[model samples]
Target chain A: MSRFPAARLAGVAALALLGFLLPRLLGGSAHVYDTLTTIAIFSAMSYGLDIILSDLGEISLAHTAFFATGAYAAAILVVNYGESAWVGLAGAVIAALALALVLGLITLRTREFAFSLVTYAAAVVCMNIAANWDFLGGSDGIVGIPPLALTLGRFSFVAGRPAQFWPVAYLLLLFVLYVVARFRRSRLGQAALMVHMNPRLAAMCGLDANQVRLHVFLVSAPISALAGWLYAFQRAYVGTDLFDTYFLVLMLTGVILAGRRLLLGPLFGTALLLGQKNFASLGAYGDALVLGTVLVGVLCLCPRGLASLWRRRAIPGPEAPSLPGGPVSG
Target chain B: MNVAQQFANGIIIGHAYALVAVGWTLLLGAARLVNFGHGQMYMMGAFVAWWLMSATGLPYAAAVPLAVLVGALLGALMQRLFLRLTLSQDLVNLMIATLGFGQILQGAAGLAFGAKPERLTSPLQAITLGGARVSCSAQDVLLVGATIVVFLGLHWVLRRSRFGAAVRMVAEDPPLAALYGLRVAPVYLAIFAFEGAAVAFAATLVAPRTPILTSIGFEQVVMTFVVVVLGGIGSVGGSYVAGLLLGLYTAFFSALVSPAYTTASVFALLIVVMVVRPGKLAASGGFAR
Candidate 1:
C-alpha cells in the first residue's frame, strides 16, 4: 500500500491542478465555467450517497431530503435571517445532521428494501411539507437569493457570476474528494465496510452494525448538505424542485456509473452526465431517458461498472468468481 | 362535512388504493421484487388509456384492456432487463434498476403526452348513487366492484391454480424450485407481467377521479406503499383491508384535518409500523392465509 507514496501524491496533485484549470482550458467562456461549476457541485452532492452506497451498502433515498435541507437551510438563513455564507454552511450541516440522525434512527432496524422504502417515503413527506408550508415559501419557493458572499474582517470576496464562483465550487469539490478518500481509510470507514460486507463477522469482532450504519449515515449527510449549501448560491434560488427524483437518480447513477468504491467514479460520472446536459444537449425529457438508461444499463450489463470492462480486458486470466449477491456484485 | 359522504368516499378510494396496489402485492409476494417504478407504471397506464381514447375514439372498455396489454408488455420488458439481477437475488441493484425504469417511463410519457394534464374519461362518471346525500359516480361503483372481483379472483388463483403453486414455490426458494425442474424464469416473467397489468387496470379505473399527469405517480404511489406495508407486505386480503382502512383514514383526515398533509400523515403511519414491527417488513410471507 505504501509502495509509491511520493508518486501517487504527485499524480493526485497534478490531476487536481488540471481539474481546477479545466474550464479555462475549455475556452474560459461563461458556458464553460457554468458547466464546470455545476459538475463540481453535483459531484459533491453525489459523493454523499457514494459513501453510504459504496461503503455502508444501503441506499437511503432520503439523501434528497438532506440535500434539500441543506439548500433550504442556506436559503432561509441567508435570505430570511440575514446571515453570511459561513453561517449558511454551518446551518446546512447542522440541519442535515439532525435529519440524518432521525432517519438513521428510524431505519436502524431495517435493511435492504425496507430501508430504501422508508427513506423514500421520508423524502416524499419532506417534499409535501416543503411544497405546502409557507415558511419555505410554499409552492413558489424562496427566490432572489444573493450570490456567494464571504467576509473575513476587512477582506471580502463575492462570487455573483459563474466564473467568479468556479473557485469556491472547485474548492468544495476538492475538499469533499479529500474527505471521501480519508473516510475510505478511516477506522469508522473500515467498520462500515465490515458491517456491510459481513454483519455476522463484524458482530463476532464486537462491532455494533447499527452504530456503524448510523455513524456512516451521519458522516455522509453533511457532505451532501455542503454541496447543497454551495448549490443554493450557485442557483441563486432554493426551490421544491431540489427534491425531484432527478437528483436522487443522478446521485445513484453517478455513484454506480464508473464503478463503486472508486475514488474518482462519482466525479467522473457526474462530469460525463452534466457534460452531456450542458454541452451536447438533450432536452429535459431526453436527458432523463438517457440518465435512466445509463443507470439500468450499467447495473444490469456490468454491475462492476464501465471501469470493469477495461480492467477485464487488461488482465486476461481466470475470470474472477462472481459475487453471490450484493449491490455492486459483478 | 357530511359524514356519510366521507364514508362512501373512503370506501371508494380504499378500493382504488387496493386495486392500484394489487399488482405490487403479487410482485412482492410471488417474487420478493420491489419496483420503485410502480408509480411511473401507473402513470403510463393512465396516459396510455387516455391516449387510446382521445387518439382513436375507442370506447373506455376497449381502451382499458389495450392499455393493460401494453402495460403487461412493458412489465415483461422490465423483467427481461432485470432477469439477471433477479436470478442472482441481488435486490439492491434490482431496486435501483426499477427506479431507473420509472425515470425512463416518466420521461417517455412526458415526451409523448406533453405536459398538459389530461383526463381519462369514463362514461359511468356521469351516473351517481344515493342522490345528494352520499353520492358517488357510477365509476366509483365500478371501482369497488372491480376491487372485490379482482381480489376474489386473485385469491382463487393463488389458492387453487397450478401457476399459483409455482409462484409460491419460486418465492419460497428460487434455486430449490429450479432444482425441482420448475422454470423459475417464466414464473418471474409472469409475475412481473401481472404486476404491470394490474397496476394499469387500477390506473384506468382510479385515474378518472382526478386529473392525470406524468407527475401524479410520484405521490400516488406513496399510498400504495402504505397499503402494501400496512397490509402485511404482499398479503392480498390484508392489503384489501389495509387499503380500506387507509382510505377511511385519509378521507376523514382530509375532511377533518388538512387535505395537503394527507401524504405526510400516511407516511407517518408507515414509519410507525416499521418502528413497531420491523420484522414484518423483511419477511415475504405466504401468498394467502
Candidate 2:
C-alpha cells in the first residue's frame, strides 16, 4: 500500500523503456511520432518551467528568452566558429544558465507579475538583438546545425539516424525527471514548496525567499536551455520564429492551459498542440481558433487543469488554504 | 527634413505612446491588474475606425465616435467576462489567458482581414507644416485631438468626480473600499472597461496612420509595458510623460541610430531602471510571491 518510491521508480522505468522503444516501434516514417519527439523536447523544457511554476509557483512570462538564448548561443558557436555539435551544446547550456542566473538575480527581487514582466522584457530584448544581428543569420535564423556525437560510445546524431537518437533522447528525459524528482524530495524541494506556500512564513522559518527563488530560477534555466539545445539538435534548425510572441505563448499555453496540476502537463499539452499541425491548413486561423478557445475554456472552467478531471479524490470538503498565492486550496 | 524634424517626429510619436500608457496607468491605478489585452483594444479601435471610413463610407467625424463606442464596448465585455472574474487571482494565469485570447483575436483578424497591412482611407491628405509633413486630414487631427481631450477628461474625472473618489478608494484598497461603502466589484469592472476604451481610442488614433497587421498587436503589447514601466507604474502623469518620452526615444533612436536599436534601447533602459530602483518600476500592487 505504501510503495511510493518504488512506484515512482517503476513509473520512471516504464517511461524510459517507452521512450527508448518509441522510435523503433513508430519509426521508418518521419510523421506524427517524429513531431511527437519534438513535442517531447518541449515537454523537457516544460519540466524546467515546472521548477518555478509547479514547485515554487512563480509565473515566469519570459522563459523563451532563456531558451532562445541557449539556442542562439549554440547556433552562434556552431554556425560561426564551425564548432562541433557537442561543443555548441555545451556552450549553449552554460551561456543560457549564466544568463538565467543574472536575470534571476534582478527579477527574483520583485514578486510575481513584476518578475514576469522583467523576464518578458529580457526576451523582447534578446529577440530584437537576434533580429538585428545579421552575423548569426539574423531574422532568418541559423540553420544547418550539425547533429550530436559521443566520444567513447561512438554515438552521433548524424550517423545515429532518427532511430539512433532514441536512446539519447530517452536518457536525457529520464535524467531530467529523475533529477527534478530527487530535488523535489530533498531539503531544497521542501524549501521550494515552502517558498511557494508562503514566502513570508518561509522567511519566518529562516528560509531566504530570494535565495530559494534564485536557486529554483537558476535550475529552471538550464533545463529550459537544455530544451533549446535539443530543439536545435532535433529539429536541425533554429530560427527567429522560436523567440517571438507565438513561441512564448506556446510555453505558457503548455503550462497554464494544461499543466496546472500534473507534472507531465506540458508533455500532454505539447503533444496535443503538435498533433494539430495537419489542421493548420484548414484556414488561416486554423489551429489557433481551437487552441485559444480551449485555453480560455480551461482557465475559465478548470483552473486546476484539464488533467484534473481524470483523477480521483477522497473526502474533499475544504483543504487548508494554500500558501498566500498558492492555488487557493479551499 | 532635418535632425530637428526627427526630434519633432520623436516627440509626436512619444505623445501617442503616452496616451496609451496613460490608459494603462489608470486601469492599474484602479484594480492592480495589468490587462495584456489592452493593446488588442487599441488595434481594434484603429482597424474598426478605418473600416467605417473605407467600407461604410463614413466621414472622419462619424468614424471617431464609432471607434470610441466599439472600444468602450469591448473593454466592458472583457472586464465583465474575464478581468472581473480573475481579479485577485494569479497574475500569471490572467496574463496567459490574455495571450490566448489575443491569439484568437489575431487568428480571427488574419482570417477576416488578411495578414498584410491595411492603410486607413480618409479625407485627410498629407501636407507639410512648419517645415515638416503632417497628415493634415481630419483623421490625424482627430486622433491627436481625441487623445488630448481624453487625457484632460481623465484627469478631471480622476481628481474631481465623486466616482473618481470611489475609484481611488478601490484602487488604493479594495477591501478597505468596502468599508467605505464603495462596491469594489463594479468599480473594478468599470475601471477595466474605462481603460480598455481609452486604449482603444489610442489605437484608433494610431490605426489611421499606420497600417494594420495581425502581428502588430504583439509588439504593441510590449511597447505598452515599456510605457507603463517608464511612467512609474500607476502614476497618470508618469504614464503620460513616459509614453511620449518612449515614443520620442524610439523615433529619434531609429532616425539617428539604426532602426533595430530602437526597441533594444528602451529595453536596455528598462533593465537599467530595474537595477537602479526595483521598487520604482514596480508593476501594479506588489509582485511579491
Candidate 3:
C-alpha cells in the first residue's frame, strides 16, 4: 500500500483513455455524440452536488438554482452583450459564487432538514424571480445564445453542433473532475470531512463549522454553474426550465446511485442514467419513476450506495452518526 | 382595496395555509421527519377528491373523507417504506427518500391526471357572502370553519389525551420513549398517517380556490414551510397563528406590491427570520425544552 503502484495508475489512465475514445470508435453517430455530450454535461453538474453531499455532509437543493444561475448568466452575456464564451464562463462563475455566498450564509447555522428546506426554498425563489423578472427574460428566458467561442492566443475553437461540442464537454468534465479530486485532498476538504464526521473534533481543532460550510458551498456552486454555461451554448437557449426539479432529482440520483466520495461515481452514474433515458426510452413519467425509484432503493437498501455492493464487508454500521434527527442537538 | 376585504382574504388564505400545514406541524412535532413529498400528497388528495366527484357522482363533501382515507393509506405506506430509517433516526436518508417518493408521485400523477390543470368544483363556491364590497364564497367560509375545528381538535387531542402524551414523549426522545416501553413504532406510524389525512383534508378545502396540477406539489406547499418553520417547527397552536400571519403578509404583499413575486418575497422573509433567529431554529423540535 505504501508503494507508488505506478502500474495500477497506468492501467487506470489507459482505461480512461479507452473511455474517451469509445464513443468515436462506435460509428460516431449524431445521436451518440449528443447523448455522450449530455452525459458529460450532466455529470459535471452532479459533481458540484457530489462534494456537498459526500464531503460536507449536507444536502443542498439549491444547486439547481446555481445551475440555472450559470446557464442564465452565460446566455444573457453571450446573447445580450455579444460576449464570447470566456466572458460568459466568467459571468457564470461570478453569478454562481454570489448566489452561493448568500445561500450559504442564510443556511450557515441550519442543519439537516432546515438546511435542505432552506436551500430548496432558495431555489424555488430563484425560479420565481427568473420566471417573473423581465430583465432576466422572464419566462421566455434568454434565447439564441451564440456558439461557444474560446480563443487562447492563436488557439481557437467554435463548437456549433453536438458532434463539435463533444470535445468541449469532455474537456469540461475532465477539468471539473480534476478540480473535485484536488478539493478532496485540499485543506478545506479535510476540514469539511472532520466537521461532518466529528463536529466536536473539528471545533477542538479550531475550525469554524459555519466557515467551512460556506467555503465549500462557494467552491461547489461554480462547478455546477460552469456545466450550465456550456449547456447554454449547446442548447442555444436558457429558460426557467433550467430550474426544473428534473435536474435536481437527476443530480441527487447520480451522486447516490454509484456511491458517494468516489471521483468517477457521479460520472458513471450520470452515464448509466442518460444511457437508460436515451436508449431505453422511458417516457417522461416513466423516466421520472425510474430516477425516483433508484434514489429511494439505493438509500434504503444500500445507504453506502451501489458501489458498496461490490465490496466484501461493505455494509456501513448503523453506529455512524445519523444526520437527520439523531442526538445531534443542532 | 377595502381594508375589510383584504382582511377577509387574509383570514381565508390563512386558514387554508394552516390546514395545509397542520399535518406537517404534527409530524415534525412527533418526529423530526420531513416529507418533501407533502405537496404532492396534497395534490394527490385533491385529484382523488376531484376524481371521486367526477367519476362516482359523489358530493364534494362526501369525497373529502374518502380522499383523507387514501391520504392516510399513503402515509402508512411511506412510514412502512421508511420505517428502518425512522427507527434508526436517519434523517438525511429519510429526507431523500421522501423526495424520491414525491417525484414518483408527481410523475405518476402527471400520467394519471394528464398535464392540464383541473378545477375541483364545489357547491359551496356558488354561495357568495356579499354583493361586491368584500364577498367570499361558502367554500371559503367552510375552509375557515374547518381550520378552526381541526386546530381546536388537535390542540385538545395533543394537550389533554394519553396518546398525545405518548407522542410528545417520543418526540422528546424516541430511544428514551422506547426504553420506557411506549411503543415508538406505533407513534411514528400514527403521526405519519395523521400527516397524510390532515394534508388531504387541507387539499379538499383549499384546492377548490385554484386549478390543481400534478406539478404544483412542491410549489403548493412552499408556504407550508414558512408556516411550520416560523410557527416553531412542531408547535400546534403556533402553526395556526403563523399561518394567519403568513396569510396576511401574502394578501397585503400581493395586493400592494406584485402577486407574481409574492413567493419570492415570502422566501426572503423566511431567510430573514432564519438569520435573526438561528439559535431559535436550532432549538426547535425539543418538545419541552
Most lDDT-accurate candidate: 1
Q: After superposition, how far is residue A310 of candidate 1 from its true place, in Å?
A: 1.3
Of the pair 1 and 3, which is ahead by TM-score? 1
Residue range B1-289, candidate 3, lDDT tens digits = 7888999899899999999999998887778888899999999999999989998999987999999999999999889989988888787878888999988888888777788889999999989987677899999999999999999998888878999889888888889998998888888899999999999999999998999988888687689988988888888888899999999999999999999999999998998888787765763553421
User: What is the per-residue lDDT of model 1 for residues A1-330, given as tens digits with 9 covering 90 to 100?
Assistant: 369999988988999999899999999999999999999999999999999998888888998899899999999999999999999999999999999999999899988888888899999999999999999889988998898999889999999999999999999999999999999999999999988888899999999999999999999999999999999998989889899998999999999899899999999999999999999877888888888999999988888788989899999998776675534432
> Per-residue alpha-carbon lDDT of model 2 for A280-302, expressed as tens digits?
43463656656666666676666
> In what order do the candidates fall by DockQ, top score first?
1, 3, 2
lDDT score, residue A217, model 2? 82
- Residue A106, candidate 1: Cα error in Å is 0.6
Q: Return the candidate ranking by TM-score, descending.
A: 1, 3, 2
Which pairs in model 3 have colliding backbones? A324-B91
Candidate 2 similarity to native, TM-score: 0.89
Interface RMSD of each: 1.5, 2.9, 3.0
Residue A18 Cα positional deviation in candidate 1, in Å, after optimal superposition: 1.1
Off by over 4 Å in 1: A325-330
Measured with C-alpha atoms, the lDDT of residue B97 in candidate 1 is 96
lDDT of 1 by residue, B1-289 (tens): 8999999999999999999999999898877788999999999999999999999999999999999999999999999999998998888888999999999998899889998999999999998778778788899999999999999999998889999889888888999999999999999999999999999999999999988988777777788888988888879999999999999999999999999999999988788877788777865654564
TM-score (chain A only) for the predictions, listed in order = 0.97, 0.86, 0.93
Error of 3 at A315 (Å): 10
